[model samples]
Target: MNQRPKLRSPPPSSAASSPSPPTSPNLNRDKAKTIIKMPRKSYIKPTLVLASLLTIFALYTFLFYTPPNYNNNSSNLLNLVNKFDTNNSNVNKVKIYMYDLPRRFTYGVIESYAAARGGGQVEKDALLKYPGNQHSAEWYLFSDLNRPSESRINSAVTRVMDPEDADLLYVPFFSSLSLVVNPIRSANANGPADRPTYNDEQMQEALMEWLEEQVYWKRNNGWDHVFICQDPNALYKVIDRVKNGVLLVSDFGRLGRNQASLVKDVILPYSHRINTYNGDIGVENRKSLLFFMGNRYRKEGGKIRDLLFQVLEKEMDVIIKHGTQSRESRRAATQGMHTSKFCLHPAGDTPSACRLFDAIVSLCIPVIVSDYIELPFEDVINYKNIAVFMDTTTAVKPGYLVKSLRRVSTERILELQKELKKVKRYFEYEDPNGTVKEIWRQVSSKLPLIKLMTNRDGLIRLQNSPQSCYKISLYIENLDYQEPATTYFGEKPRPAKLACTIISMS
Candidate 1:
């Protein structure tokens, strides 16, 4: 009864307070005016980006980071390899094409006098009377230039047998041997004696005529041809004819005023008796301070020697022997240079002599006293470190030569000797790969000038027989005609740049 009474009396506020069921937002139409949603992303995408960053970091570490022990390992490896390395450096080689000259031109000189004069034997005996051998370079060039070789340290050049394919035309004329084959006229001769009676003149004329008739010679006017004129007087008779050829000369002493120049000619070295000075005598053990032993009376350059001899004769440390080269003198020279620290290399009749090379082999620093002295391999060896260059005017001054030598410090002398030891190979011919390689390297440098001349005159192609043969011409044909050049060469065609033989395809 009380419940019924209460229900009846329940107010509107009590009815609103009664519990209600949950309503959807869409059910409230007036309140649901607008809605907004957020986009979703995958968790795998962010993980992939993190993996890529780590991979890049690993690569950077590998490239830029070096362990502290890396230098130690590198030095150890280099030391191990250096023992076997000859240290010749990278040899710059040029392709050489050798012409098969008639035997009379190249080998005939030695054959003619092999029995009576014994070719180089007489020359070697004569040189043993002095500090160095005179005709050694001629022998070396002739023996090793085009001779077949099985293996050699990066030689500076290669040889080709074909004339049409050569960068330089080498005439194998033994010009120096020809001069020595005949008896030498006395220096004081009056009439016909003044002129050489040697057959070198005849050989030279024959060679020039043969060369002029060759296709290569006519193309360049013999400008690119190589001639070995070691003796200044060896080829003087017909120098005018071959003046334009590449002259390999010992010195310009015999050349007329306007004929010889460094621009057109190469200075060759006198062959030294390498056996005497080949061993390493201690530089510190050298007893004498200054030494000179050679001819005193010379024509052009010996005037300075005479002056030095007179001035230094009385000096305590200076030992001067003014005499001709005799058996006793030659033995004395070997001993003198071996024991001395400084050797006086004043010019003789020429501006250069074999003494300088002997001094180099002896490891005795050279006191070069000449005004216009030209040196062999000047491009490769720096003579300043191993030699003292005092012009004739300065060296002729009394006491100057000794004074300058004395002023040089012991450390400096030892340093110069060390440098001298390094370059001894450059002046030696026993190793076929040594000095000849250097000569070929220098000659190779002149190829640019030769090419320039050839290109300027449009004579780059060989004007031989019937076909145009050159690297450029061959390339044009390969591109345009696709024709093989085997018919012309009669062998597998080499690259046009290296083509050395010409044959007729027709």
Candidate 2:
């Protein structure tokens, strides 16, 4: 190792007999006191200069160094409030208050059934293995809305804790989860001995009873309350009672005539089982003409699908496989749809199925064969641009479906596919326009009507209770220091006494 450099020392100072003229001891003492008493101001100036420089740097970073698109990425609460136009400030935000329902209604069902029924952790972990398998609608919605998002613009609503501050009351009950879990089998399927009790109905009954006890429910009788009944059969037993409430569902297939309308109830899209397809599999790479993989033996409206399958099974370039509800089936469906140009979306038990969204995700143009089908986000998206809709009679006619599909210009089909790709984000579970945001937007549209009904109900209540005594409390910040308050009115007011109290804040 190399030796270190040696250090040098300065010469010692010599003592001096008195730099200044000799003074009296008392005079020295007074001089020392005066020097010690002089104010120390040098350190403070540098400290203040440093503080000013730091403040200037901070201001520069905030006002100039920030990106021009800061608002797009900002999650600040003030930014959320400032996005709305000055004229529409009052109507921009809709405050929703969620009810504290029992676990059995939402997450309890997920924990109990989602893990076990979906194959424990193995199935959930493998969700990424296959590109197109999505969680159930109830799971998607419950998970998405549980957290707040910064990108939600048109539906920039807030969830409030206090019921009194709410524009709409949200019942966070996962109706589908409760129904799918602990499913009851039919007596006819298991021979007459197995009795079928309506579990979904019983749950709804208990839920209604619990809701009726709450003070918020008594206010407008649930007119401002919103319920999520995404599954067709969910809350079917108590449909009439909750009909007046804002009902959010995937479709109106399960509702009878006059049960649900577009004005009162919102149509939500089925959570696509597939992730978005961003591949370059244009019309050229898509060798298969049309594809449909579902149950060939379905009842009611699904019979049309069965007939089409029989007719198209032998057709060249058309893939029609018998469908089953299994992982293998889902994987096969995903692969088949990826290679096809047009995916067939026919009525099953209901006119709408998750298949349409799957096709959209796979960049396959959907050939919708349901005449009475209702699509989600129709107000925002024109379905005709992305899908080919056919009447039942026209589709069922001999060779009509294939002939009509063949008649579609290759360019037209490509256009539909491009449009399908554009709308795929809306149907995706993670997108801002997914279930939560769309549901909020739908609910926001109905707020004006809901407010009108609420005001009318209030007037009716007031009229019915003319003798009701109302007590108002006024808070004064500094009672003793402020001058006496004065009031002016054109008309005489009712005689009332005022009370005051003094309290120290500091």
Candidate 3:
């Protein structure tokens, strides 16, 4: 009878309590077991998981990945692995190896030069905004190289990164990339500027209009040509002339310079407006303030760095002595130019050394050491309005600095302040600053809605054109060592031009 008491359906839908169907039997049975298991486990699962994730992150960052402070905008452009873990990113950043500076230097040099120049050590957040000039997607700047006693800026087109595409090797600095856009197709390729080359996206577009591949080089490998900064008359008087294409000048205002017809103009106005609209190619919102302070060194130019370091050490000592500086200073004392009033430049290097831009960003007086600066054609329009240039090569004296500093009085400083106020307007709203922006604004605006070098497809497309194929190959060549200028860029580059036809099917 007990074995036959199984498998019975006892309850009816509306019947009152015919049988509870053993519902309470299960509830009663689980209560005892639930009490025992509940005490066995703690409820810190979320907290423990969070803690584990944090520890893993910390371990990975310290041992495997490097985090960066985005304060320095230029740091973003540098191909620095330690600062930026770009090893896994999808962008092409320039990796600059500084071989221009002296070896075995002072600690303050990093601060005085990098920090004082940009006004800070560079917070990682600010860098995300800047990325870099239009040349590349990312930048990794380094200071570990065999610097020369007397440094030189050598720009060479060689294959360093892509073996397939050539790159530009800027000696004393690091490596660089080229973006192809509207080809500046030239019938004759004579001068270096006229040749198929690109500094930013805009210049790339301008070059595409006139495409010519004639690589000419008495072209020794190292720093072959110096961008001599001087009056237009002196510049045109000494050399051969190429009428077809444009010249690459330093100062944007040089485009605005009033030169005699007898005198050859240093830079073209179109050149200055080109870089203005190149997006990230414009000035940084936040930057490091680097102040290059030192005695004049035209004669011994050899110990310029030594003297600079000596001066910096003394200056830093004074600051720390008065508690203004510190022995524990991790960064340059660069808050002085917080809102754009800082800059640092090389005593002698290129016409517009890093200082010119540093001062431009800080909105400080550039304090030029050499008068021979042949600023690119139209640099002055904006450069002159911003930077401070002190001719150390000619007026070498502290009194000059004193007078110049004094001249930056409430009125002159106010003038600079007025101009500095327009910095954002110039960048976003468009000013005479953008070299490429203006051109795109001018010609490209009226044309079809086609992407320029700013678009990856547009850039890659340039690599396929029969003419641009080789030029692009040269422009992209940066695997290792230096690539010859003539082979990649091509020979017979007497007259410069651009290569803008789309050839790559992919």
Candidate 4:
């Protein structure tokens, strides 16, 4: 519009030579395509590389990893599992096969004893009562196994009708009762010539004859068999013959070291004869400081009873009298123990007696004076927690035991009473999860050892080699108990020594 210097267009030839004005729209479109296509190609290569690395790493981990050793840690694991199963009532039980012996071996003994006592007839199936004595564990265990499976859901042993499914073979002979009911005879005495009937020796011989004929007994050489010989003299004639089997015994007094040991045998609690004290644990009702009411004279290891009585009978607040198993005596002994703070548990004919269990059920702290005593359920029970253990040497000293009792603080006494209450149920035979189940549990624990022994009996033959000596050291945790550790001396036939020690976790 500036007045129009009407300039003619430059020549078309000159415009064509200047590269056609740069083409701006087509250049921008080409740059956009390049950006999108380049990013797509770069992403594909990196994605493939990452996936390959992940696959290789997974394969390496799957082929090369190793777990840590668990052999030494098995005890802790087993304890955890046991705690869970105990609280859940899911304990694994032993499958028992009970032999169907004739009535003369089982309830017949009970019936004969009852008839002699002028009692009414005992119904075979309805027989639940046993003589009120310490050697009644056989009766209790037999009765428990005879019950229906549904009735014993929480029992530690189940009766299997078929022997093929059995973990143990139970010979339900009333050996202890038979011994008690029959007349005593010399070791060399034969049967009575007047009557062609059975005596204890004849009954024992008959049992062995019947047992030797059984298929299972011959199959395992009786190594997997179970016999309830709770009395020290229960099966005296047949003891050596049945020594390879599992013997449920009271103590090792009458048995040789080779005949029974903690390795292959189970120590059972004597059936308590006194009434159980159901009251709370406290000292307010207790009046006496020490109580003991048993035979003052005894034999062998039991000689210590006389020595202990000489030192304790004259002490103040003490009741130490000689009593036998009678109605009035049981009542008096029950009263004495229930009111006493501590009950004396000296050695009997054996290292143990029913008095110890009686004291346990009565909630009286046991003053154990037997040096070589082997206790029942020692693996699970810490005797130091519920009882006072004194060496036989010191216990017989004139002023030692009484002075020790006076030194125990009230707090310590209460603690002991509380522990006694907690464990008393284990000594009870009537409770569902009591002595019967506990005995079965202990037997079940011996299954592994039984199998080992059974297998070794067939494999190893020791020709004139001395019996292998076992010095078992039992470490009791969380206590101050200690005994001299005895080393294994394989030269002679020495009884296996159980050495205990305290191991503090703290």
TM-score for every candidate vs. truth?
Answer: 0.68, 0.68, 0.30, 0.72
lDDT at position 501, candidate 3: 39
How well does model 3 score by local distance difference test? 0.33
lDDT (tens digit, per residue) of candidate 2 on 1-506: 98897887765555444375677999989999999999877788889999999999999998888456666656565555556433343365888888878866765555544433342433442242211222265555555555654434455566667888888888877687666655345766552333232355678998888888999888786779888888888888888777768888878887975577787778877777654677964787788999999888877788898778768888888999997777888888888888898999998787888888889889989999977987888898999999888888888777888888888888888788878777777787677666567667777888988877677666645633424222212323333435544322333342222221111110
* Candidate no. 4 TM-score: 0.72
What are the lDDT scores of the predictions, listed in order? 0.70, 0.72, 0.33, 0.82
RMSD values, in order shown: 17.4, 19.7, 23.4, 18.5
Write candidate 1's Cα lDDT for 114-192 as tens digits.
Answer: 5323333344322322112476566666567546643444566666667665778777676777776654447885443
Writing each residue's lDDT as its tens digit, candidate 3 over 111-146 gives 233332233544442232221332221121121112
Candidate 4 residues 187-257, lDDT tens each?
A: 99775464323378988999999889888987777889999999899899998889888999988888898
Worst 10 residues of 4 by lDDT: 497-506
| Ranking 1 against 3 by lDDT, winner | 1
TM-score of 3: 0.30
Which residue ranges in model 4 land beyond 4 Å of their true spot?
1-92, 118-128, 183-198, 460-506
lDDT (C-alpha) at residue 438 in model 4: 88
Best by the lDDT measure: 4
Best by TM-score: 4
- Model 1 misplacement above 4 A: 1-93, 118-132, 149-153, 183-198, 256-258, 274-283, 457-506
With candidate 1 superimposed using the best TM-score fit, by how many Å does residue 252's alpha carbon deviate from the native? 2.3
Model 4 clash count equals 0
